[model samples]
Target: MELLERLFMGSPALWGGGVAHSVLILALVVALGIMLGKIRVAGVSLGVTGILFVGIAFGWYGMNVDGHLLHFLKEFGLILFVYSIGLQVGPGFFSSFRKGGVTLNKVAVLAVLLGVGTTVALYCLTGLPMTTLVGVMSGAVTNTPGLGAAQQAFSDLHAGAEAPDIATGYAVAYPLGVVGAILTLAALRYLLRVDTQREEREAGSGTDALKDLTTRRISVEVCNPAIEGMSIAQLRELALREFVISRICRAGGEPELAGADTKLHGGDRVLVVAAPRDIEALVALMGREAADTPLMRDRKMISRRILITKSELNGKQLADLKVRSTCGVTITRINRAGIDLVAAGSLQLQIGDRVTVVGPELSVAHAERLFGNSLRRLDHPNLIPIFIGIALGVVLGSISFWIPGVPQPVKLGLAGGPLVVAILIGRYGPHYKLVTYTTMSANLMLREVGIALFLAGVGLGAGEDFIPTLLAGGYVWIAYGAAITVVPLLLAGLWGRLRYKLNYYTLIGVLSGASTNPPALAYCSEQTQTDAPSVGYATVYPLSMFLRVLAAQLLILMFG
Candidate 1:
């Protein structure tokens, strides 16, 4: 028993500063925290945030590691976490601002401003240190990236001195931050006497104009004289919208695959894949809906979903490929990151897209070769681009910009630099012949590991002061944090509902996204049981994340 105690708890080598000891502690913290996070109470779990608390407990119990190693792990982990997030959201970041998304983003912006304003006000009124307030604000919003950016900015300005209280403040306020958004949603529901079912039904009634543009497919018969003899390419131009001509059948002939060069004749039926909203124009221009078309069930023509694994084909437009003219096949739809887009001429192909190609079996086999459908290529992650992008990000982050009236030049810092670089790489890497495609599971693994390491380091660093500060009037931060979380959400939620007439699901999604709270988003998803909340969440999440990270840094630089 004495030997076991010394070996497990009192060994000099185990407690002393070393790389292996630090790694072992980090591994234990992450593993235990993940296991703890999986235990749900009342359908709510702490998720990965549990790592922070577990690390804190271990630290409080007197475990220690090399400070330099801990700092390095923390910063590197933050970089990985933000970079992976940027990659995930970059593809649709710009495109998310169409039509109704503009309003949703506006609401999100307002909430962010409100949160910053509240933090500033608390700093002034409560006489609390700006560092503490900034941490509390980040925790109130449940934005770990913001907390990271604030820490980076503080360190940059303060000559590498660690702010142990920052993470403590974040840890103290984080629990309510999760619950407050959900409670605000519930309060608003009761205060306004909302009818979720009716709002859901109304949302289903086609209030959004962009709904049909992405996820609908239909068949139309060709009868209009103007387009009777026009090629499919010309017809697409006249319609002024994106649609794919998958197959065409004449009155007396068997159905065959249609392509850009396929000419239309009167009394011919064609299978069109397009946005549901654009269907009306096509139907009016072409003819009427051809229900139960023989072409849909035609046995002679084959339809196949081909995975794109060719690096050279990345960012090439569908028209540029000329699959129709070369392989006698039409790509009706291209699925990227789980969203299906109509295969239009101008649509740029990504490395990981799954395209639906319709043609003869031989033609599809030929097209498959053209697309490089080798699954083996996708198994190997393109790590060169990731390292190159990170290098560029470090360079970019080190560059400083002078703002008018500021005492010091502002830098994007470690967190902001990597995030911005990753977003750009994810969005435009293909244009420059860079392969940015990562499997979903691979990206998730990178993100989880990064965040786990970062949080563990933070917890260990802050644990010593955490309990002391809480006993010394730090409990008041809960009120401050609650105010920060609930007030902006209430105002923004009301504005979205009253001004924009947003549905309940979408409004709650906006509130959750503005806060950057995944638990609240999950709660909204569970309650709605529809895609409306997800749509709003995805539309506003990218902008909100960027703004929160920037806002936290600005608060530290200007006030801290």
Candidate 2:
């Protein structure tokens, strides 16, 4: 009863005494903040960021946590959050620059540079401490890692002396930063008088140009005498295009499953799977599209989706797997991270890939066994690679580089190092025999817990000065933050539209991604009924996140 009374009464010493009290306070903050975040006002909610404000509230009411514990939780949480993000974006990070992504990323980089320039200008104009302004910039851009990076830089410079409440400036600026991005997007739509439907239509069916491997099955009847005696492999070489011959039929016989060695004879019918753009050329080369081909009507041959879960197959090429030669099944397509890829012989297999195979039922079952289609095996997390990667990240973060004129050496710090390492591991891990596949739920769980713990620490640490700072001209930080948020978005939006004539949905998505604001992305998805926004967001997110974190630390190191 006495312990319950102490817990309820909120005794400052009791609350700050040990790990149990600190954990309890953190738990309550996260729980209550999550509850508060669920209450939407006009379709916009704080989401997980509500924890920051709730932590402030707890701090304002004199809730205390042990200092050492708070610091450890905050830093560890930040590492987890950033490392998870790196893994998520690493696979597509370099590929994001292909085709149309190049243009989208150009605009996104412009937005990032413009935001940095605006913050620098504000610092010079307002005479605000760079520490505070950097915090404001991080919040205004809705980048949490940037805030963490900035704070870490400051601590390194000051040697753990009384540090300014960086999170206070972030807390002040973050809410409107979200709303401001949404407003900027909406305002651009109205000002430009964009036709969303027409823009989407003109954007080439809203298909990702990089992964345009559409599963178009064109049944063609052979008529070209030039290719009468050629193998399917020779035909592929002649066509200079990647395609799968799923089924083939003789003039008077039932359809049979096709392999690389399948021969093309005059009047033979075959079903070819390739991109839409290549269908016409393939049809011309073969003969013509046969509407009544027995290939489509074949019941003996079937297509089955096999999930790749074998660790040994992480980097094996399809040619090495020899699905067709051994299992008598042809792989038609490989789906990775929601994008369909052409299943060429040179294509390397990865864990978690879903490959579509066309063959007889027995052949497909054989192929499935070869690929290890065990969900239980895939569900098991590879913790060794993760911990090893994290350890490497810490080592990388500790190594500092001396600049030509700077007084201090520059480091990637806790946030940037793990992020960069995680991306590399995620992208090239398979080649090195490291399987970095984590279920979406597992990744999300790690990310949420990490961010929540980090935010709770920041809020509690800054709570003492939050109200005081706000009352004393800190409200102007909102105006500064708004300027920081809205101006760069508008400028980038204009440049992307006028210079490149970018599709409206893609432009807004680039803007949202440049700001690193997911709430704005949700708004973009809601406003545009196409995946153009999502594609643009994904293309820019990794680079934008890297740039934002690096910029924050540089600003503190150079100017703070």
Q: Evaluate model 2: give its TM-score.
A: 0.88
Candidate 1 accuracy as TM-score: 0.91
TM-score of each: 0.91, 0.88
Task: Give the whole-model CA lDDT for all candidates, comma-separated.
Answer: 0.85, 0.85
| Residue 55 alpha-carbon offset, candidate 1, angstroms | 1.3
- What's the count of clashing pairs in each model shown? 1, 0
Model 1, 276-296: lDDT tens digits are 667788899999987745887
Q: After superposition, how far is residue 330 of candidate 1 from its true place, in Å?
A: 1.8
Q: Kindly report which residue pairs in candidate 2 clash with one another.
A: none
Model 2 worst lDDT window (10 residues)? 206-215
Cα lDDT tens digits for candidate 2, 272-330: 88866578889999899887546656778788899999899998888888777799888
